[model samples]
Target: MVSKSRSEWSTILSHLVLAAVSLHAAVTSAQSSRGAAAGFLLQTFAAITMLVPGLNTHEDCLAGAWVATVIGLPLLAFDFHWVNGDRSSANLLLGGGMVLAVAGDHLGPEGCSVAGQAVLLVVSVTILIVAVFTANTYGIWGGAMLGVAGLLSRLEEDRLLLLPKEDVCRWALTAGSWAYCRALHTQRLQWE
Candidate 1:
């Protein structure tokens, strides 16, 4: 049996916490923004999958997580714009990007493809731009962190200090998810 490093253990624990936070955000946001809630729910599932031993190393599991993220990000972006009454071109872009992502997922390889990665990057950057323009603090931080996570994921074979790039990526993703859930929770409170 291979021994796991401290960084890996931390990453796993963080994901578990992320799952719970995402679930709570989903439930709280459901009444106000179904789209955002759905996105959060999907993310919750993705995070929970990390808890299964050795599952994260599976290609299918990785693909499923990517699928969740690709679809979830667009839903979150679309819902944020809609709730704020900013029915601009951003919403159209988000919708189109989501559809493209879904189609790409179905047509691409069993694991994540380059085309899928490109779509995810584009969608993430677009959301960041939207958040910046709309002055959403939580979204701004979340999008930025997720963007970093996405970039880091591409460097999975690399290592920093004693930790692998994947561990750093997971940490960034967890922070991003936490911020996103906070954004959703705050929005829900606003509607109350």
Candidate 2:
């Protein structure tokens, strides 16, 4: 078994922190300029974390993608005010993502391949895009959290070992997306 070194762990920790801060800032903000600036900062860090050496692999990308999707759900809820309205769709997406993640974790090992993973990745991206368009703020975050979680489950099931690299990348991507969305929303508010 290969043991990760200190630097690797540090890199992962940084990524995780930035990711959390990205979402936290967005969720807590009252859609002010400060929140927008913080969101941009968070996205920038997220991109930087993804480019870290020895961390760019298919699995890492998938894991990163999953983290972004799963964690973004709540961010969306706050943005769209889903709690006040019928939140059945949001709830359904949340449940579906969880179910897929678990199912992927267990059933993924049965038949896994690089090509299959790639296809899944594409699907995840598509969902993210659709969420951005259809649901707006709510869709983007919710879709991200759900998509990433499901993808992570499948990757975990298939891989011989799970490393922090994938997770770091996932969180980074997720945070970056949140930042981007938050920034866009803030800019739009300024115009209104």
Candidate 3:
């Protein structure tokens, strides 16, 4: 029993490590277009592997993670590519990051598992970080959406930041959209 418990914990720890590493690679890749392809590949693999732990033992969480990964990866990758304009990339990343953040909220451990929630929060933040590095205002907005969602989720689960029970995730889809608009306006002004 003792060893089994240890093994389970080891698995959890491994997942955490994978998630963190992938996020790191993603952030690095987003910093610039140079060598972005390699970074994107690494990020993609790491993000998928990160959800492995929740697959067998935590199906619900796994589902959320899978949803987020499947949707977010392509969006993020496409947005990373220059699309004839800065605003487009920013908007795309914002939307993608928001999706990831909200999905992460549902990654709880069958109940009110604070640790599980925190992991999702980290994932969301990582998504936002990538958006920020790769884009501009849209990325910041994406980060904000993730932050707001995380906060609301915490509050819904229990207390606020200090306490927790379940993990509720949200991505200010609305806010991200607004940011995209604002970014476009600013871009127009700069160009003028």
The C-alpha lDDT values of all candidates are 0.70, 0.46, 0.44
If scored against the real structure, what TM-score would every candidate get?
Answer: 0.75, 0.36, 0.31
Candidate 2 segments exceeding 4 Å error:
1-6, 19-23, 26-92, 101-105, 108-192
The regions of model 1 sitting more than 4 angstroms off are 1-4, 53-59, 86-94, 97-111, 185-192
- When sorted by lDDT, best at the front, the candidate numbers are 1, 2, 3
Score residue 103 of candidate 1 by CA lDDT: 74
Candidate No. with top lDDT: 1
Index of the highest-TM-score prediction: 1
Task: Assess the local accuracy of residue 68 in candidate 1 as a C-alpha lDDT between 0 and 100.
Answer: 69
Please identify which of the two predictions, 1 or 2, would achieve the higher TM-score against the true structure: 1
* Candidate 3 segments exceeding 4 Å error: 1-66, 69-108, 111-120, 130-135, 156-174, 177-192
Q: Report residue 17 deviation for candidate 3 (angstroms).
A: 34
Cα lDDT tens digits, model 2, 1-192, are 889786667656656665566656555554443433443344434444476677756566555544333333323332232332435644554454455544544545333333234333443454456445545464355346535544664544432234454554445345545544553464345446
